[model samples]
Target chain A: MSLVMAGVVGALFGAGLLVSGMTQPAKVIGFLDVAGGWDPSLAFVMGGAVVVYGLAWRLVRARRREPWFDAAFHLPTRRDLDARLLGGAAIFGVGWGLGGLCPGPGLVAAGGGATTGLAFVAAMLVGLLAQRRFARG
Target chain B: MPTSWLLALGGGALIGAASALLFLTHGRIAGISGVLGGLLPPAAPDRAWRLAFLVGLVAAGVAGAVVAPSAIGASVRPLLAVVAAGLLVGFGTGLGSGCTSGHGVCGLSRGSPRSLAAVMTFMATGAATAFVAGVVS
Candidate 1:
């Protein structure tokens, strides 16, 4: 039941990505290209999402102590900022600018059978594995 | 606001609602990288929900392609660029412990300082990279 609910939530999220034009590389690049012809559409998307989620977070916390499906809420507890976080984000930013597709949109597009998406996902998996190996060693 | 901007906002709302739903029901953050990354070694006991969510995400992508083709755009970047971007994205997200959905949307909604820092770093670097790419290309 919880798994089904998770799927439903994922579907809704993916639909949102499509509707917000996040699946389009050109649109993403346009938004990132602040020095060029900047498109503020992505900003609206982020703003709208953040507002809604923020409200929901407050409401849910006020009403519920625990989730419906899980015994405890699995929220991140880390408060400290470190070099790993900053360096990783910097690298991600460069990749995002170059390809204009992050993990969510990349997965959605690949699932829809785009060759480029597939290629990107494949390389991404490789990178993930490589990073894991390096981290372990 | 333009019609497109409204759509973007609405879509973003939907995304937020989905994230909220996941949190409210399952006590989980809709962080794509973390959800997907946890499955790399497949040791976690809550893998079912994660897999289900990804399946639903992919299904939505397929449905969106059929229902609203125009919103899903094709990639114009070359194979080499796409692959390189994918590598960077995967490795960076792994090291950073979050991506756009996790850090940009969910984390910001929760008002996490780490997330704020991550978003600022990524946005700055992303915009800078886009500017450089524009100048070169």
Candidate 2:
């Protein structure tokens, strides 16, 4: 039941990505390209998402004692900023600029049968595995 | 604002709604990298939800393509560039521990200082790279 809910949530998220033009690399790059012809359309996207989520967070905390499926709310507790976090974000930013695809959109695009999307997703997973291996060693 | 700003805003709300549903019910952040990353080693304790989320993401993408073809776009880049971008994104997200949806959307809403730093860092780097790469003027 929880798994099904997760899938349903994912689907809605994916649908949002599509409708908001996030699945388009050009749009993402355009928003990021401040020096180029800047497009502020995505700003609305961010604003809308933030506003909604902000309200939801408040409501959830005020009313919900426990999550529907989980015994308790499981949230990230790490608060300290570290070199790993900064460096990784920098790396991610570069890749995002280069390809204009993040994990969510990449997965969605791949599912849409784009070969380039498939390639990106494949390499991304490999990169994840490599990073994990390196971290462990 | 571009003509598509409305769409972006609406779509973003949907994304936020999905986030709310997942987080409110499960106490999960809906961070894509973390969700997907945990599945790499196939740990059975929490694999089901992640897998379900991903499956739903892809399935939704496919469905969206059929329903609204224009919402999806393709990334036209060299195979090598695509591969490199994918690897970097994967590794970076792994090390950094979040992506756009994770850090940019959910974390910021929760008012996490770490997430604020992460979002700024990645957005700056991403924009800078876009400029350096000549994608931005």
Colliding pairs, model 1? none
Q: Which regions in candidate 1 have their CA more than 4 angstroms from the true location?
A: none
Query: Model 2: runs farther than 4 Å from truth?
Result: B42-44, B135-137
| Deviation (Å) of B63 in candidate 2 | 0.9
Model 2 C-alpha lDDT per residue in residues A1-137, reported as the tens digit of each score = 88889999999999989988888988888898898899878888878899999999889989988899989988788889999999999999999988888999999988988777899899999989988998898
Q: Can you write out model 2's per-residue Cα lDDT over B31-88, one digit (the tens) per residue?
A: 8888899899744378888899899999988897788876778775677888898999
* Global lDDT of model 2: 0.88
In candidate 2, residue A83 scores what lDDT?
95
Residue A72 displacement in candidate 2 (angstroms): 0.6
What tens digits encode model 1's per-residue C-alpha lDDT throughout A19-133? 9988898899999999999998898888888999999988998999899998888999998999989988999899999989999999888877787778888988887777788
Error of 1 at B99 (Å): 0.7
Residue-wise lDDT of candidate 1 within B84-112, one digit each (tens)?
A: 99999999888888999999999999989
Error of 1 at B62 (Å): 0.7
